[model samples]
Target: MQRHSARPLAALATIGTLVLTGCGTESANAGAEAASSTGAGRTIHAQKFMRLTQVHDETGMTLLEGPTFGKDGGLFVVDVTAPEGEPKVMRVNVGKKTLRAVHTDGRGTYTSAQFSPYDGRLYLSDFSHGEIVSLAPGGGDKRTFFSGEVDGAQMNPDDIAFDEAGNLYVSDTRGLSENEAHGRVVRISRDGTKATVLAKDLAAPNGISFDLNDRGLWFSELTEDRISYLRLDGEGKVTSRHTAIRVDGGIAQTDSIAVDADGNLYQGLHGRPAMAVYDRHGERLATVELPSRTEGLESATNVAITPGGTKAYMTVSGPDGGYLYTFDALAEGIRQSNGG
Candidate 1:
């Protein structure tokens, strides 16, 4: 079970706004009442807040990751296929709700896809190959941007983020066993020349995002069941560290995380059938349960919200395969590194 620290005022304020914009007061209040009675804080049924729909599906696609929005509002995702099929970077046609492969020749397991705000190119993390590759905007000109070992350990980069100056931050989840916590957070220079380790000894750091205020870097430790904040100096050196949220009952299996414009954090709870929402202070705001457990929607691995915050796109994986899901959201998402 997951436990949240007390910060009721911020949570209530967020709930109040949700009650006003998400639905009429009555329905939202009813959902809140039901969730509060269960001692799970203020909550709203996901369906009541937004409609959940499947935008795309394929048989050989064994996993799905990264539904990040490009500068032009187009969504990019990765399809991690079987051994016989190569992984693909796909672009989501938001209007038609369809997908088109952007990079069909990608090698290894593509775990995360991000569009650079400064250069307008797509960057992907190849977990199996231990490298970060770059692709042209329309999926052409694929090249290896960063690779090789970090601190004597191979790079098993899991997720990627960029700061305002175009410097890239990667979370390297590089442990073979459950007790071996050898994860690391590294920063690559804007020119892609120099690599520096900002922190080490992380227990499977998976999800990473910049705070809306640009004050610190936020990341999740999956095995440790905690989300933490790190303040970096002008040269990308770690100055301080703080635990934002930690699961008291053991592993929460947290994966990808996203931040909205108003400083709310939306995190994918891997083993649970829901997404956890937290305030800037790391207080629990609510949990939005995905619909239809029969569809293998329980394993949420990544989440991305649109710029206007009208809808949220999530990547879920299970024994059967992977899926891309979209639903209505309560607030606008933070798109840029500086929270513009």
Candidate 2:
């Protein structure tokens, strides 16, 4: 009886193995070949780059949006939502790989935060609070710096950057339901007293960075798959506008941007799960691969570079509690252009 039972089990296992092999073949056949670059009416296969290597995975659950460096060289990230449970600013000691809650505003969804070198204050844009709030220089008391309806308008202020003269720039981006093209870039004065529109009709402008020369501004439009530039006066006013780099045959959703010491612009291509480095002249130098394929593109929102300018840092969004990734720049084949 025992031999009879063992023989039947062995036969059943063999049948299951055959079924699995058939399924594997079918799955492989379902995927078409990846598109190839065309050359003189011929197809040239393009190799996919290596996926992003992990840097620091979060132990907690805070949804990190913008990761900026503090004056003390600490990495500060704006937690749009508190980790698994608590509500607060997600502060990471990169040197130690430890996480802490710096501040809890009760109002959640604080998307992007930056430290102002001019006054040593922390300027943050609250996506949920619907205002721009700042911390006392060196991280003390927190208060609303700019709030109460943008240009008497309602919108989501997602990211912000500052100019040399101590002026504040905020990305007042609108939601999907609204179709009035209310997205805008607003400049706030040093005193936090005056705010004015520098450019309008921007489609989901998410990240803003100053060029190396401090003569112009580069910002990303999430809905448009295009990086753009605006000429600015010493006082931070728009003189001209033009598209800098268009993501060819891909979505233009970008969340954060950072520049290396040499002035190359590195942008986080959110939903595409890639990082695109552009020469100062707006040409794409490389596209670094990311780990996950499901990120919303708008979620991998911020990029930061170490002072040494060798390694770059980026954050992933949501349920993943976001991750900090370090990138090694492959600068050999990349050309240095102008405009940074």
Candidate 3:
């Protein structure tokens, strides 16, 4: 693994002013209006209703991915600074607007962190170690939950989500380039003993989230710029599959996804200034344009909504540095797990 010198933390400052365009109403009101109106092709300027503020400035480190909320309302994030150096996991107090380190051991390359609704523990995906590690609610006592290959394939877990029954769905992003269909989604049993592939032949499957109704699983194919929905039976097996939405033209890469209580989907765009919003039936409801100078250069890597769905936190990665941004989301976010 290669190592690089760590850079100093940059002075904190407010990112940018909220500018709502194309629509007269504020984002919250516009979102409400867009949600109700049956008319298609209507655009809601999310900046009008939502206030974008910089919570933390990870100037020197690479905020690999995350913004998963714990039961206590604290948001968790990971820092993949150097391949040889230990990765750090930080927790953000959403209400207090403060950041603190939770776990920072030079163990493995950690990509994602999730709080299990059933177990009330935090689960992390160790990409370098090819294993899933668990931590106590307060980030203590790390232990291996699942490791080794699944069905003879090396584990390269990226994003993770849990169902109502405590089962885990992981996106195994095989490689960097999308030249081949090597990505797949794997499911680990509740007890963390058994693992199985739920879907395959995917081109860079990056994010996975359960539907608001709990009847389907939604995931994004980053390289392909497509989002898919999978219907599962009682046993959590994929029974049906279909492309939920596809992005074409400018800003075509799709990253992380989050669902709201109203069955609305919020997707992070790779090379666009806005995040795309979709209704339950796969209808494009709004395109939330964010304020940033690196609109085309940066990518909105991940998004997490609070349990109440009042606010949304998104991470943006670019040459300037990594930044965490928060804004008001009128709709309440749906609980990804059974626990609150």
Model 3 RMSD in angstroms: 8.5
Flag clash pairs in model 3: 27-48, 27-49, 86-106, 309-332, 309-333
- Model 2 residue 25 CA deviation (Å) reads 28
> After aligning candidate 3 to the native by TM-score, how far in Å is the CA of 152 from where it should be?
1.0
Alpha carbon lDDT of each predicted model: 0.65, 0.57, 0.64
Ranking of candidates on TM-score, top first: 1, 3, 2
Misplaced by over 4 Å in model 3 are 1-61, 82-87, 175-178, 249-252, 292-297, 337-340
Q: What is the Cα-based lDDT of residue 303 in candidate 1?
A: 73
Show how many residue pairs clash in every candidate, following the order shown.
Answer: 0, 6, 5
User: How do all models score by TM-score?
Assistant: 0.81, 0.74, 0.79
> Between the candidate structures 1 and 2, which one is better when assessed by lDDT?
1
- Angstrom error at residue 16, model 3: 34
lDDT of 1: 0.65
